[model samples]
Target: AQTVTQSQPEMSVQEAETVTLSCTYDTSENNYYLFWYKQPPSRQMILVIRQEAYKQQNATENRFSVNFQKAAKSFSLKISDSQLGDTAMYFCASARGNKLVFGAGTILRVKS
Candidate 1:
C-alpha cells in the first residue's frame, strides 16, 4: 500500500513572504510521479508542481516549486512571495500504475 502524509494540518504566512510546506510518502516502486495540488475556498484542486522519481532536478512553476528528496521519500512545496490569492488547501499526491493516493492535506492562509 502507498500513503502520503502532510504533517502540518494548517499553516499561515504574511503577504509577500515565502513559505514551504512539507510532504512525505511511502512507496515501494522505484518509478512514479509525485504531485502537489492546491484547492482554494471554492473547492477546486489545482496542480502546483510535480516531480518524477527518475529526475534529480526539482520541479518549479513560477512562484511554486518542489524540493523532492527521493531517497528520504519526501516532497515539499515552496511558495514564493505568497499572495492573498495563494490561500488554499494543498494536497500531496502520488501516482503509480493505476493507483493515485493523496494526503490529508494542509490548509494555507495568507494574511494581509
Candidate 2:
C-alpha cells in the first residue's frame, strides 16, 4: 500500500519569511504524481504545485515550489515570502491512476 508521511504536525513562520514543509511517500508505482495542496479556513483544497515522477525538475508556482527527490521518495513544499494567506493545513499527496494517498497534514501558522 502507498503511504504519505508528514512528520511535522504543525509549523510556524513569520510573515514575509520562507518555510519548508517536509513530506515523504512510499509507493510501488513507477509512474506517479506528487502534489502539494493548501487548505485554508474555507476548507478549500487548493493545488499548490505538482511534480511528475519522471521529471527531474521541480515544480514551481509564484512563491510556492517543491523539492522533489525521486530517489529518496521525498517531496517537500517550499513557501517563499510566505504571507498570511499561506497559513493553512498543507497536505502532501501522491496519486497513481485513480487512487490517491495523502499525508497527515502540517498546519502552518504565519505569525505577524
Candidate 3:
C-alpha cells in the first residue's frame, strides 16, 4: 500500500517571494509517478508538476519545481516568485497501476 504524508496543514507566503511545501510517501513499487495537484476555491484539481521514479532529474514548470528524493521517498514543491493567484490547496499524489493515492493537502495562502 502507498501513502502520502503532508506535515504542513497550512502555509502562507508573501507575494513576490518563494515558498516550499513538503511531502513524503511510502511505497514498494519501483516504477511509479509522483504528482502535485493544486485545487483552488473552485475545487478543480490542476496538475502542477510530476516526476517519474526512474527519472533522476527533478520536474519543473515555470516557477514551480519539485525536489524529488527517490531514496528518501520524499517529494516537495517549490514555488518561486509567489503570487496571490497561487493560493490554493496543494495535494501530493502517487500513481501506479491505475490507482492514485493522495495526501490530506496543504492550504497555501499568498499574501500581498
Candidate 4:
C-alpha cells in the first residue's frame, strides 16, 4: 500500500514570499508517479506539478517547484513569490495504475 503524508496541517505565507510544504510517502512499488494538486475555495483540483519515479530531476512549473528525493520517498512543493491567489488546500498525491491516493492536505493561506 502506498500512503502520502503531509506533516503540516496548515501553513501561511506573506504575499511575494516563499513557502515550502513538506510531503513524504511510503510505497513498495518502484515505478510510480507523484503529484501536487491545488484545490482553491472553488473546489477544483488543479495539477500543480508532477514527477515520474524514474526521473532524477525535479519538476517545476512557473513559480512552483518540487524537491523530489526518491531515496527518502519525499516530495515537497515550493511556492516562490506567493500570492493571495495561491491560498488553497494543497494535496500530495501518488498514482499507479488507475488509482490515485492523496494526503490529508495542507491549507495554505497567503496574506497580502
- Provide the overall lDDT of each model, using Cα atoms, as 2-decimal numbers: 0.94, 0.94, 0.96, 0.96
Report each candidate's C-alpha RMSD, comma-separated, in the order given.
0.7, 0.6, 0.6, 0.7
| Model 2 accuracy (lDDT, Cα) | 0.94
Model 1, span 6-38: residue lDDT tens: 999999999999999999999999899999999
Q: Tell me which residue pairs clash in candidate 3.
A: none
Q: Write the per-residue lDDT of candidate 4 for residues 14-100, one digit (tens) a residue.
A: 999999999999888989999999999999999999999999999999999999999999999999999999999999999967799
Residue 89 accuracy (lDDT) in model 2: 99
TM-score between model 3 and native: 0.98
Q: How far in Å is the alpha carbon of 112 misplaced in model 4?
A: 0.8
Which sequence of candidate numbers ranks them by lDDT, best first?
3, 4, 1, 2
lDDT of 3: 0.96
> What TM-score would you give candidate 1 relative to the actual structure?
0.97
Question: Which pairs in model 4 have colliding backbones?
Answer: none
| Segments in model 1 whose C-alpha atoms lie over 4 Å from true places | none
Error of 2 at 109 (Å): 0.2
Show the lowest summed lDDT stretch of 10 residues, model 1: 91-100
Cα miss at 65, model 2 (Å)?
A: 0.7
Off by over 4 Å in 4: none
lDDT of 3 by residue, 41-111 (tens): 99999999999999999999999999999999999999999999999999999996798999999999999
lDDT for residue 94 in candidate 3, whole number 0-100: 96
